[model samples]
Target chain A: MDYSKMCPKFESAAELLGKKWTGLIIRVLMGGPKRFKDIKEQIPDMSDKMLTDRMKELESLGVVKRTVYPEMPVRIEYELTEKGRDLEEVTNSIQAWGEKWM
Target chain B: MDYSKMCPKFESAAELLGKKWTGLIIRVLMGGPKRFKDIKEQIPDMSDKMLTDRMKELESLGVVKRTVYPEMPVRIEYELTEKGRDLEEVTNSIQAWGEKWM
Candidate 1:
């Protein structure tokens, strides 16, 4: 991440947000809190392992939160935190730029 | 590349711009055109091979242009195209977010 000697902070952010599938995972979660199944549904091809890894990474970074509820059946959901929501500008810009160019 | 299944354009753009070292390379070039040595000076650890490969990829995608001059020194430089420059917004936003959060 420190490969970018110009700006270590920016490089760190790029490493987190710029990894393949990371941005899209955040984009999907941005829709709202969702169950694991729902997230998997939206990203049909993502392996369970990959999804779990990304979620754990995001969660550890304080960008995403995971909630567990007691019920007849165990329930879990993922949603963006306030800090994560701040990335809206980044996501929107990327989407807009992609739509225009790609 | 289309792992998102949400917006292919955005996914494509992310794949191109979000890869390791790609964003920083563009960030450095945004300052203006520079020779291979200059770019290397800014990003010290990047191997010559990696820099060459990224430059070739960006050049092929029309985001970067490589100019050759028939001078005594055989001058060569890399610069962002209009399309590439448009990414300034993306770079700036990431930098801002990084400085604030990271």
Candidate 2:
């Protein structure tokens, strides 16, 4: 229990998840894949530019996978990768805590 | 599974925990009550001013309790309230994910 030294892994994880709107974005995706508009609709307060930025960040981190369907009007969708799905525990815990306390 | 509407409780919890250094500070305090110096020492990159600000924020949120023991020289300690301790699940989930992925 003596956490005299900070753990780098935890620090990195915290940094990734601690980004504004990152957790909620992940939470939204937890339900399943969705179009850009769907994701945007869920988080009304987040600007389009911010959502774009966070999505790209998550995509780069391999937490999210963006797929483009080559149709008349290109269909774009976002979904969680396995790694992203792994965060269910983290999100679920947060939800539980939030419901009880926040 | 349809999270069409964002949960206010989850949003509030995410906002609180997403703040920089907040999770790490809580993680450090998870060991037990520690003096300000101890907390700062664990998170070496955080400035004194930042730590002061975060501690005050956490205290005001009722997630942290600050105690002062009157002596020749006053001794102070920071500990998690029951509400704060409840965050163990959240922190632990993050730690587990970090170790596996981050």
Highest DockQ: give the candidate number.
2
Clashing residue pairs in candidate 1 (N, C-alpha, C atoms within 3 angstroms): none
Residues B1-102, candidate 2: write the lDDT tens digits. Answer: 347678999999999999999999999999889999999888999999999999999999999999999986999999999999999999999999999998
DockQ for all models, in order? 0.50, 0.77
Candidate 2's displacement at residue B2, Å, is: 5.0
Full-model lDDT for every candidate: 0.85, 0.94
User: How good is model 2 by TM-score?
Assistant: 0.97
Per-residue lDDT of candidate 1, residues A40-71 (tens digit): 88778789999999999999999999999988
For candidate 2, give the lDDT of residue B71. Answer: 80
